[model samples]
Target: MFLTPYVERLPYPSRTVQRAIGVAAVVTQAGIGVTGSVVRVTGSGLGCSTWPQCQPGSMVPVDHAQYQTVTQWIEFGNRLLTFVLFVAAVAAVLAAWRIVLDHPSRRRLVKLAWTLPGGIVLQAVVGGMTVLAKLEWWTVAIHFLVSTPLVWLAVLLLRAFNEGDEPPRPVVPPLARKLLVPLVVLMWLVLAAGTTVSGAGPHGGDPGTHRFQAPIETLAQIHGGLLVAYLVVLATFGLALMRGPVPAEVWRRYGAVWAVALAQGLLGSVQYALGVPEVLVALHVLGSALVIIATAALWCGSRDRGAPVSGTPAPRESGELTPAR
Candidate 1:
């Protein structure tokens, strides 16, 4: 009876390789995010002015001064990062499939790791559509939206790698659970709303020639409104964590995320008020990525592991928090 499932698990080195794949996935996903941001900031969204190429006629352009030259390179660079991310996702899925076939509970984790590449493939399609559709609001919004779940799934795979053979962490305390999950979800929502505004707002300048009739002021208001809402929600969580009888480490993470979020929000406001110079805008996106990765790490640390460890405090769990997972 055990032969089939056990054999399935024998194709890979299991935990050791799984951990390496998990780390590589995170690094690649982050690279994709940053490189994509650079492309957007450079107004390179339509760089190729053609899907999957530098131009309609050639791969490497004969003309050095064509708009396609700079834009194609920037946009193609982002695509290259996507290819790297895809490879990492494949490694993760293979590692998971070979490591968990015999462990029934863990089999689902392997499946989830595989889902990431599917998401990235769809993202690449949408990316091409965004340029072909001339940066239409919906296509671009969908493109950015896809990355959030990819990042979240990457977090899940990493968390599973950290889990090993242990049972689920004790049920999270109700108050802390209430505080953390909602805030994390809200942070993601804020990112989604911002994407819509980005697609609709004026590109600094680009060859796409696409423009939106929606007043830039109105779009900025909408994005800023979501930002303020997230800031308030995070503050509430911070207050709740301070009052609730939770681990000190939990409190510290809450504080750190709040600090990053505040800085991000401030940079965003400066970008808006000053008309979003290219450099600051790029930093704003980087700040947003950091906030997401950090909040995810904090959430996994708090709710996913077992009993508290010694000298930390009765409420503090030692083995529970595992790096990014």
Candidate 2:
């Protein structure tokens, strides 16, 4: 109870500040995943030779005979990015807490905000496991897979900033909305298949790391087939939306997803044909992050959550509370 007065006296964050923080959270979350791919393709996964520490009794990279200096720094740099991600997540939580609203909206925003930091902590632990496991294929795959949902949730949190606490109503037709379920499932499957292909491919993060015991050609074919299915479903969903009364915003978001998916497919094909070069591998990871972000935005756009609650107070230039629009 002693902290109540101080908490109330805290300056409220503007809506612009809140949305900016949300965007930062989404970007950092996705960027970290891309950087991780760099670590893998560069064979720097064990540059630190340990977890939560760069080496024995050292929290930073040190001269080691077993790993290249560049590789050590690359891995350490990726590890440092977790701190940046955590900072963004904490900022998101604080910004959400400062938004003035009705009890329900306030509570919901706060709850969603907490997920950002919470997921980062979870990812940190999983990351440590990935390192300690000697860059095992499944562990690496798990680390990447975990980021997908976090990216999705980050987008939802961003959407929540401009919306009320009301239950979501479909902006598209009911059937079109229903089709999204299959589309989303296919997206997940495609990601999983892609990871499986990665496990079987040449890039295992380290020369000593065990590759998944499967023919790379077979895995690639499976992954490609899943991608084809996802594209087909997504095209069908787009057609359904076009045949009905949908908002322009929804159409724009869906179009972005479609464009990103096609680009990603083309990149995947080129990466495969070129023998999965390191640069293209990093680009492919970036494309994967884009796919997740675009898909999540489209999903959010398909739902209508009304407007922000009225009469909520925001901080003014004089440091006094004034009603927000």
Candidate 3:
């Protein structure tokens, strides 16, 4: 609701300035996520063997044959993404601060914009700890989880910047306690399980890089099984969409989620069943992040009520669906 108002009042730039900034932020964050996966894949979590700086004397090593050059790049690349994330966070904070002072609708957007930097700061500290602590699994998991909410905020900011001013909806529908909510929840669960599977595997980021141990295939199998359950729920939801008075936007989201889940499942099977090469594994991680972003976007965009029903007709709703003041 706070964001809704700011979205209405915020001024638009002629050159898609706001959208560009938002997109940059998302891209940077995604880059960070990918770099993280690389760190895990290459067992380079401790390449630097220290944080805030790779080592006491040098930022980038000049001579090192023990650690492959490619491995050095992967770990350093993750660090570089951190810098980019910080810059994006600053730009967003400034933009939100500007909007909050004058516009009522924008106040919340501004507030949320500020939140990203704070989270990043904490993330940076936690990241250092992960390195210092030698890549603890719980720390790693927390670090990974923290990124999602920031990404969610980034997505919200981008959407708000693009949305034009309009009077507040007369009525907002109550969200249904339906299967969709649980389904999304289950998706997250499966993802968490995947982290466990990853941690137990030899390839799970550097054990000293983090707290996790070698990934056990038995655990990986359980994680995979959960993924299958996730697919079943998604399919059931798809069928329900066919029967229920779901909105077009909602339908589109459903399709997108299902598509990502399907792709992720296939990639997972390939990565694990085929002996788990670094390349397939990296794609698997990227695919997971993509699914998370898309899922968050879909969840935000959906509503229990709005618009004209295509054929069968929506139940009478007398709120935002009608004309506003």
Best-performing candidate as measured by lDDT: 2
lDDT by residue for model 3 (258-289), tens: 78888998898888888888888788878877
156-257, model 2: which lDDT tens digit per residue? 888888788788888898878988888889899999999989998899899899989989899989889998998988888888987789999998998899
Under the 3 Å rule for N, CA and C atoms, how many clashes does model 2 have? 0
lDDT of 2: 0.85
Which segments of candidate 1 are over 4 A away from where they belong?
Answer: 1-17, 57-66, 101-104, 164-172, 242-244, 305-325
| Ten-residue stretch with the least lDDT total in model 2 | 97-106
Error of 1 at 119 (Å): 0.8
Better of 1 and 3 by TM-score: 1
Better of 1 and 2 by TM-score: 2
Q: What is the lDDT of candidate 1?
A: 0.69
- Name the TM-score of candidate 2: 0.93
What is the lDDT, from 0 to 100, of the residue 160 in candidate 2? 84
Off by over 4 Å in 3: 1-15, 60-70, 164-177, 207-215, 304-325
User: CA lDDT, every prediction?
Assistant: 0.69, 0.85, 0.67
